[model samples]
Target: MPLPTDTYRALTQSVSAELASLRASTPDVMKAFGDLGRAAMADGALDKKTKELIALALGVAAHCDPCIAFHTQALAKLGATRQEIDETLGVTVYMGGGPSAMYAASAIKAFDEAAGATRG
Candidate 1:
């Protein structure tokens, strides 16, 4: 729920480890992933709102709970409303089916708790 700074750092470190492993095994693949990440961040056709929505959907599709939670928090910091988050998850459900629905709900709960902590 309430994600502490340690938890966030740990999650990011774990993801970094995974990426490092992938880079060791397939440098080209890792390069592509880096390229894509850079491209996503670059100002282009998709604005911040669209990019965050896409990130949320991808996080759901990948079933990465940490990613989902993190992005939801990020979106909220960017002033995304509860309704928007709910609708994004709904779209995730449409794309990823039932399992994604469950994960999305969990992600939402985690995000809500984390956001509440910041508010207090």
Candidate 2:
């Protein structure tokens, strides 16, 4: 079954508190991580949308729920359609096999929720 519409959002919110604490304790490391993320997602040969898609796929493959949530939210804001998300999930599953298939479901739920949140 798909996750609840608010699940990913809630998960992200919960993670944010812990992440904030970690960042407070490890400011330099957190800043470096944030910088890396910004640099990786910057528009270049590939646009931010495409980069987000790749990141979403990798997030699913890695079973990283927060990554999936963040990237799906990014993808939705970037105007990614459901078809695009599904196609990316297809590639993610093919590359990462059964485990990825599990997380891909969550990824789509994340996308849908984020898309709806943007609209509402």
Candidate 3:
């Protein structure tokens, strides 16, 4: 399904709330997972923006709608241009094959939606 412009923010907010609840319920596990994600995405060899694009490509490769939405918004917020996103999608399509191509399209739709959101 094509991603609606509002869906990205809604999904992210919903997920954030759910995750916060889960963190309270399973503090140890959630903390570990959250810490790991933060650590992996932190600036080091690659900047945060690069990591976000890598993550966005990974989201497409994995065919995770929520991940695509989340990463699309993150990439936009980090100032990724269309060219960079297209390049990342190219690699994603190459690595992930036919299925990834479909998801990559979805990712693009989500990215456009996210970009629109920031404008207004």
Candidate 4:
């Protein structure tokens, strides 16, 4: 099933609030992240697919459920296959050991749901 609009909205708002708070408390960190993001975007060596995969890996490493879900959808929209997504999550499992397994599963489900919408 598609995630409810309210759920999506709340997730977006919460993430925004958290990011805003982080920016306020650690402006340098936010600036650094922004710079790194820009640099990554500028690097033509990594295609959009590879970049989303990298983002997925980071989301898994950070244990951010919302980020995982969001990036999963983004990757799916970019035409990443289910197998590719699973493989990416497997990498996360290898890096994060055990606790990340569940998060990866959840992310996969989120990706599937998002993909379903686009297919239909």
> TM-scores for all candidates?
0.67, 0.93, 0.88, 0.70
* TM-score comparison, 3 vs 4, better candidate: 3
Clashes of 3: 0
lDDT on C-alpha atoms for all candidate structures? 0.74, 0.90, 0.87, 0.76
Better of 2 and 3 by TM-score: 2
**Candidate 3 ranges with C-alpha deviation above 4 Å:** 1-6
Candidate 3 global lDDT: 0.87
Please give, for residues 1-120, the per-residue lDDT of candidate 3 as tens digits: 654335777877777777887889999998899899999999999999999999998888887888988999988888888889999999999998999999998888888888888766
Candidate number that wins on TM-score, 1 or 2: 2
In candidate 2, where is summed lDDT lowest over 10 consecutive residues?
1-10
If ranked by TM-score, best first, what sequence of candidates would result? Answer: 2, 3, 4, 1
* C-alpha lDDT of residue 53 in model 1: 71
Best by TM-score: 2
Query: Compared with the true structure, what per-residue lDDT tens digits does model 1 show for residues 69-98?
Result: 667767767677778888988988998999
Runs of candidate 4 exceeding 4 Å displacement: 1-10, 13-39
